[model samples]
Target: MKKNIWLDGLRSVARMGETAVVAAKAGIKYATEKPSNAKLMRETFESLGSTYIKLGQFIASTPSLFPREYVEEFQGCLDQTPSLPFSYVEEVLASEFAGRDLTEIFASIEEKPLASASIAQVHAAKLVSGEDVVIKVQKPGVETILYTDLNVLHWATKILEKAVPKVKFASLADIVEEIKTRMVREVDFIEEAKNLEDFREYLQLTNNQAATAPRVYHQYSTRRVLTMQRLYGVPLTDFEIVKQYSKDPSQVLITAMNTWFGSLMMCNSFHADLHAGNLMLLEDGRVGFIDFGIVGQLNPEVWSACIAFMDSLQKTDYQAMAENMLKMGATSKQIDTQVLAQDIERLFSGVLMADPQELLASKPSDLNDIMMDMVAVGERHGIRFPRDFALLFKQMLYFDRFMRVLAPYTDIYADQRLQMQMDPSLLLKH
Candidate 1:
């Protein structure tokens, strides 16, 4: 216990130093050259240790909450950090497995990691019984580091929220709170294992042959280590590879979209982070979803409101849209429906009036514009949206961009393949 306390103190000191250095570096770079703000921001976040790394990931996932440049730039901030040496991996393995040799359980384990992130690194291995697996090993002391960093961040955010009201649309406190929730969950590999299994089962039950998630080996898994099947595929961004495998790349994309849209209603939680890196096209013409570290859960009430919002968007019912958002997100502060609708209309009126074919051809993504409008609306009315609604809206914005890239000729809102309906029990029962 004394050792643990000492370690925590050391972590706190390290985090503060790191944060300062990162902040200084960012300030220097911004002052010296007009570098891409998104790139500089991501680099600074990476330097601030695990908490900010996770925050960068969240920003990469949430297009609706940030500007387009930031979202697109942070996409490069994948788990690309250097891994701990193999000696560290071995020490962790022995300590966790009661001094047993890795060979005792695995027939073979690769020294080279398949991928390394801020918190963990994955290695390809085979179980002694001959099953192929990918082992995800957590870096030592990551939990302590993450905890200390988040605590410091909470204080920092509180200070910033008081000092700067408009650094970005989101208050520093709210953003830090959201980051804490996600980072805590990410530090536990067991939870991710469960998420992987649940998603696999959901796909199986739904007979979703178009896509497949990896299978987890729960027996060999722990809070720090996860063993799962390795999936081989090219990321969806490689249109050339996708074309070589499938007759039509757009068909694969549609299947992926349809599968995800269905899961939003049927599954308990859906994969909230579906960037090009996380999605792939396998050799067998199936979409592969990798990484379940961050999933989003929609309560029944919120799900109902989301359905209403999507339907309203399709029908251009701005009043209903405003009402649904208020119910789903706002904290009791009344917003004038007519005023909100008028604001929304003003924001989208030009885009809507453009020829449908032109809209499809140009493939205009309006997530940043929409978020700016939302911020305007929020400032006009004292309605601060909860974090969950912010996350859902971010996912919707990502889907909108994905559809534009995959099928630019199709109207994403009116896509017959995407299912937006809700189950009766979800809304009414809860």
Candidate 2:
């Protein structure tokens, strides 16, 4: 009952603040001789707090599903806001550990954060035993804010859907459910610890050294606190630094691609979020993966269908591609495979004939043109791709974009270029 009272009071305050914000936004738009809408939105979201920032990050990550304007605008919302103070950090640590002081276990901790996202901020530290580590502390009251915001957002979405009929197909409630599942998982650092350990085991079993995930110190970790081995490197998006390590950036890309692709087949879950920020090129010449907040798993049937879809794309077998896509996606009715094949072939014939490098350019117009074509094809076939498939497809599109910046000449599908660093014994046999 107390919790309900607190939540109700929070919602009332939020609604009042939201009304003021909306009014201010309206006035800003009306008087706009020069208006930076993105900046305004970012400031408003920051004022609104954690939930909006988290949603902004989601929009930035999901390119295929959102508008170009929104995607480009939200890219600036990568948690540049000020982090909670050291006092708050100490409080979180104390709360999680129950009366234990941070200095008791760690010889030193740098209050300056390495990275600060919506949910948590990471700090570099050293254990008393002399191990260099990074501590991730969940900001106080973030979960409460998230729950409150989610509830309010759900109500707003329902209201918006009622007013706008076109969005009825993509139910707002479903999107909220998906985001809630992922966000709740993110607040629990213990789950991230497990994900890191499982990924480490996967790498060991595969004998892959092209990339490295952080090592978790489970003893000191909790739902709100995490201690991991600190990694030093450049973000993978830094082409200039990546070129310093390898003469052929194309090979570096191929290794990164194959390493991640192999995990989909060999591991229980695959990293769903592989944006450039989450990937790093370490000084030791290894890829560093950080942030395991969102992941994807596939049943065997879906996995088989995905493999078949890839094989078909490689073969340029449109009929097989259509079949695999149908099997992989959800459909309300049986569709004609032959017609779908014809539609896909027509859409991609010109595209497939072009140099892959040309297609990889992330020019907004170029990407929009292709996406519009896919929607057209979907309309013709009476088939809608599932959100999971769209998520994977968008990741591939970003991979293509990265290839343009990191490696121009690489053939992503060519056999000589497509080598998996994990289990190179197969390479020796070939």
lDDT by residue (1-64, candidate 1, tens digit) is: 7986897788778877877887988899899987888888888887765667778877765544
Candidate 2: give the clashing pairs.
none
Please give the distance, in angstroms, between residue 254's alpha carbon in candidate 1 and its true position after superposition.
2.3
The global C-alpha lDDT for each of the candidates, from Candidate 1 onward, is: 0.73, 0.72
Which tens-of-lDDT digit does each residue in 1-430 have in candidate 2?
Answer: 7985786678667765775676587567647845566656655666666778777766655544565566667766756457878889988888788877767889998988887777888899999999999998998777777787788778888888888878824577777877788788888888888888877877787678888899888889999999999888786676788888767677667777877776665666777778787777778888888777667664446656766766776677889978987877667887999989988778767775744334445454466456546644765576665555545555576677677778766556554757433353542332
Off by over 4 Å in 1: 1-11, 24-42, 57-79, 158-175, 300-304, 355-365, 400-408, 411-415, 422-430
Error of 1 at 314 (Å): 4.1
Model 2 lDDT, residue 67, Cα: 57
